[model samples]
Structure formats: structure tokens, C-alpha cells
Target: MDYVFGFIGAGNMATAIIKGLVGNSVVEPDKICVCDVDMDKAQHLSTEIGIEVVSEAEKLAEMCHIIVLAVKPQNYAEVLEQIKGTMTEEKVIVSIAAGISINYVREQLGMKCPVVRVMPNTPLLLGKGATAICPSENVSTRDFGIVKSMFSLNGTAEVVEEKHMNSIISVNGSSPAYIYMFAKAVVEYAKSQGIDENTALKLFCATLEGSAAMLMESGDDPDTLIGKVCSKGGTTIEAVNKLNENNFCETIKEAMDACTKRAEELGK
Candidate 1:
């Protein structure tokens, strides 16, 4: 119960989760550790977040109660090989590497290692992340709860079936990029109309935030809300007409489908 968390990668997502844990008092700063091949990156995070940076992967794995594999999917094999010596029954491995599965981690470790697969979005950096986690069959319920709570320290964490993890990747994990694209388009359009770039950005960003709040607070459905804004023959209707003409809905569907397809491919 020291709740020490060790991150193998000192990347942005790992940095976000580490800050969240400390900000929310889930784990003390001194107990968190990071070890990366890039010593500079490790040292930066250590100094920036007040976390310990260990030079050796084995030391990080041996000292921490929970090990978070936060590196890219391609680097998992290398980190797996490096940490293999530190694998123990008491250690729990939680991976946020995209497209990696619980079974893959167990196979990499060459043991019935308790593993949790997590897909977390970039919004976690802002303390509003949405994360979906699925655990290996070897993980006990208590162990799973500890893992889930660790993520919940920064954002909404839910336990889901592993089969659906790929699908959820489209729903939330990569959805932020799609949303950002939409917002960027909106901001650009405003600039095209001769509005100040900063003003347009503020307006469009606020509009997005307000729309999300309305979706959560209003009892009515989304289509109903759209209809409310698009009153018969209004400016909103004109924009909606153009969007429909451009096949906006189908475009989004296609993009999301592509994301899910890639996720499926990566897991294989």
C-alpha cells in the first residue's frame, strides 16, 4: 500500500497522469518514479513534477507497487525485456499504450502477470480525461479496483470488456483529435469572414463548451436541440444546410470507422 507508481515512459500522457495523481493527493510526489531511455526526458519530469528518476528499469520495477507502461506500443517489447527481471506476483502492470492488450502484456512478461489495459485520452492533461480499462483474467477484483482508482485520480475511469476496448478507442481516445479538427475549422472560417483570430478562437471555444454543457444539462435529445437552433429559415438552418450538403455526418462516421479499424489492426 505504498501506492508507488513507476512510469517506463516519461512522455506527455505519463506526465499528465503523474501530475494528476499528485494534484489529487492520490500518491505523494516522492513515491512516484520514472525511468526512460532518454535520460534528459526522465530528468526533466523528475525535476518538473518532483518525481524520482531512476537510471535502471529494474530498479523502477522492483521498487514500485504499480508499474505503468506509458510508452508507445512499438516500445512495449523493449521495455518488457528490460523489466522482465523485476516481475513479481505482488507487482501490477497497468499499460496506457494505445492498442496494447492485457494478454499481450502477460505474453511479453512470460508469466501470469496481472495486467490492465487502459486507453486514456489527452484531456487527462487537463484533469477531464476519459479512460477505459480492461484487466487480464489473472487480476483479482481488489487489484483491479486499485488500478482503476489510480486512473480515476485524474479523470473518469470505467472498467469495460476487453473486446470493446478497440471500439471505445474511436468513441473517446481519438475523438478529441476529431473534435479539435472541427474546432479548428470553425476558427478558420471565422477568420475567413474577417474576424480577429483571437476573438474567433474565444467565441468558437466557448460555443463548444456551452454546447457540451447543454447536452449534459438539458433533458431533450441532441437532434431536438439542433432543431431548436435551426428554427425555420434561420441563419443556423443555412449553416446546417451547407453541412448536410457536405455530408458532414457521414464524414464523421467514416473518420471514426477508420480510427477503430486502425486500433483493431494494432492489437493484432
Candidate 2:
């Protein structure tokens, strides 16, 4: 492929996507270009990944067909302004910065070029992420497909309305941290009960993995699945009763609601 892919930042998210794309053979190393404020970091990544490193954002933009805005939300405006006049109709700009809206990019770029906004979680580093994609009105179907395929190298990608991005952030982007917190609590409780750390971690992870697999494979309602496992007067039922008494479900809902609200605020 003759297409060049450029990344404006070379942080973890950019690294993950670059690794995924190159590892999957979706794009060759030479076809990728990167530019970061820290030239040393850019040079390091270029040497490690075999892609070219440029010092200027305009230089990267001018050479690539797809430009990924991997910088932080706070830096997005400045980056957009830097390349606004240089971006052409043939280039598609994709942003992974949290809270930076498509309209912001559109206005900064003069609303003439295609822009795609994507929300991807940290798990993308492990190639198991769930990303929600939103394409601006200027994006064509062909461009959307290209952007979707790019993210698909790291994980699944689904196109959703921009209005639903915050919800997706709560459910997918921030959910991993929630799961980690739950797992930590489980391990701590196990340790209190005299289990060793390694054993407890193994048990906790296996249980979570199996439970997630069951949910995916059975297509059964979660409550129904729990009911099947927790028979009357059984040990599992007793544990379920304890969790219910502690308002676990309600607490989890509240936490997710908080995450959704924060995401909305950031987008503003």
C-alpha cells in the first residue's frame, strides 16, 4: 500500500495502535510516520518500530494519507490549528483524544476534510479493546471503513452516534478500571481468609474469565445465569444474598453513572 499513516503523538495509545497495525501486517513500518514534541521519544519509537520520525507536525501531515491525533485533549486545539491549513481533502484525520469533539476538529480544520473520532480504552495495549467510532458528516463511507479497519487491528470497533460516545466511555472505556477494582477486592478478601496472594490472584482471574466467557457463549440474561448458579439453600445463593444485602449492584450502577457524567463533562 502506498498510503502513509501519521501519528502526532507517540505515547502509549499511539504505540499500541502502531504496534497493532504493524504486527497485524495492516501497514508496513515504512508507511508509518510519527511526530512528537519530544524528539528523542519520537526517535526512539522510530528506531524500535522502523517508521520515520519527523520533528514538525506539518511535516508529518504533509506526508501521510491518514493522520491520527493521539495527543491529549488539552493539546488537541493547538495541534489542529497547526495543521488546519495544510490538511487536504485526500487526508483523513482520526482523533483518539478524550473529550475533543468532532465539531471542534471540524471547525479547526475549516470543516472541509473528513474527521473521525474514536474512544479506545487502555486494554488496546493487549489487543482486546472495545472502541466506539463516530464519523463526522464530511466523512465518506469509504473513509469510515478505512478508519474502522485501522482500529479493528487492536480490537472490535463499532460505529455509533456521537451522542452515545459518553455512554460508551462509561461502559467500555472506564469499565476496565472498575473490573480491576473488583478483582483487587476479591483478592484482598481471599487473603484475609488465609489464601496466598498468587493463589488468590489466579482464582480471581480464572473466575472472572470463566464468567465472562459464559456470558458471551450462552447469550443468557445475567440474572438468569446467576440464578442457574445459585440454587435455593446453596452456598452460591448465600454469597449472592450477602452481595445483595450490601447493595453491590446499586453501588456499581452509581459508579458507572459517575463515569458517564465525567465523560460528558470532559467532552464539554
Candidate 3:
């Protein structure tokens, strides 16, 4: 496709998307452009990715068919103001800022341009992230499909109601930290039992990977799978009892609810 893709920031998320687009041949490097306040960072990324780098956001917006707003949430309004007049109806604007609403972007831009809000976590760097995409009313099916396909090149993408974006952030975006914490705790517990760190890490990671695969391939409910693993009066049952006694599931629910509340607060 003869399309131009532009990014307003050269941070890690922007870099990851650029890498995916270029590396996967989804868009040609020459057709991509980036702008950042940090000229050095923009220049470095442009050099590494073989894309055009402009020092100004307006210039990038004027040139690109798709403009990705990859700046932090706090800077989104000013960035939108700067690029407002440069965007045309034909341009599709995608925002990766956490807690930024589609209406907020639309109001800031003062036009009915196609706007897509996406919640993608840092794991996108590994091409295994899960992203939730929400498109505004101005976006056509073709435009939404194109944006979703671009993200699917790097990781899984799902379209959902804008109201559910905060829940998706809690479940998929911020949940990675919870998984990492659990892995760390598992490793530390193993170390306390005289196991080496490397060994513990390998075992823990393998278990996690295998369990995830089982969930996907087996098509069985999580409770059913857990029941299968925990036999009556078995070691697994003992562990399950301990976890239940500690209200592990309740704690996880509470934590996720807190994450959703925080996301809502930030968005507001």
C-alpha cells in the first residue's frame, strides 16, 4: 500500500510499533515518518528504522496518511492542538496514550476525523502483547480494519466498546505486572527451598507457558483444569487449600478493580 504513517513521539511504544511495521514489511520505511521534541532521539530512531524524521509535529501530520499519537496522556491535548489543522478527513489518527478518550481527542482536534484509541502494554516489544482497540464514529470499517491489521502484525488485537477500555487495561495492560510479581514470588520461594535462581526461573516460566498453552488448546474451563490438577488429599489440593485460605482470588479481584478505578481517574 502506498500509505504514510507518522508518529508524534519516539518513545519505546512508538519505537516498537515502527519496528513492527518496518520489520514485517507492513509499510515501507520511506513511507513512515516520526516527530519528537528530542531531535536526537528522533534522528536515532529514523536512522535505525530507515524512516523519515521531522522535528515538527505539524510537518509529520501534513505528510502522513495515518498519524499515531504516541505521547504521554498529559501531553495529548497540546499535541492534538498542535496538529489539529494539519489533519484531513482522509487521515486516520490512532492514539496509544493510556487513559485518553476518543471524545477528548476529537474535541481537542475540533473535527470529525477518524480516531482510534488503543491500549497496548510494554509486552508489545516481544510481539506477544494484547491490545484493545476502540474506534470513533467517524472511522469507517476499512479504516478500522487497516488499523487493527497493523497492530495484529505485532500482537493480538480486539475491538471493543470504548466503555470497556478501562477494564481491558486492568485485565491485559496492567496484568503483566501482576504476572511478573507472581513469578518473582515463585522464584524467591524456590530459592528459599535451596533451589538455584536460574533453575527456579526456568521451571516457573515453563509452568506458566505450559499452563497458558493448555488453556488455549484444551478449551477447558480454568476451574475444571484446576480441579483436574488437584486430586483429593494430594499435594496440589494442599496448595489449593492454602491459596483459598489466603483468599487469593478475592485479592486478585480487588487489585483489578483498583486498577480499573485508577484508569478511570486518569482518563477523567
Top of the candidates by lDDT: 3
Which window of 10 residues has the lowest lDDT sum in candidate 3?
1-10
Please report the TM-score between candidate 2 and the true structure. Answer: 0.93
Model 2 misplacement above 4 A: 1-3
Can you write out model 1's per-residue Cα lDDT over 1-268, one digit (the tens) per residue? 3437898888889898888878877778998999899999999998998998889887789888889998888888888898999788678899887688888888888888888899999898888889999988778888787778767877799888998988889888999998989888888888899999899988888998899889989988999999989888689999999999999999999988888888777766
Q: Which 10 successive residues of model 2 have the least lDDT summed?
A: 259-268
Better of 2 and 3 by lDDT: 3
Q: After the best TM-score superposition of candidate 1, give how far the Cα of residue 110 lies from its true spot, in angstroms.
A: 1.3
The lDDT of model 1 is: 0.86
TM-score of each: 0.93, 0.93, 0.95
lDDT string, candidate 2, 1-268, tens digits: 2447999999998999999889988879999999999999999999999998888998788888889999987787789888876789778899887667787787888856788989999989999888999998878887787778777878888888998877777778889999999888988998999999999999889999899889989989899999999988899999999999999999989998888787666666
lDDT tens per residue, model 3, 1-268: 3337989999998998888888888778999889899989999998898988887898789888889999988898789889987888779899887688888887888887889999988889988878899998888898787788777888898888998988888888899999999999999999999999999999899999999999989989999999989999899999999999999999999999998888777777
lDDT of each: 0.86, 0.86, 0.88
Top candidate by TM-score: 3
Displacement of residue 150 (Cα, Å) in model 1 is 3.0
Candidate number with the higher lDDT (1 or 3): 3
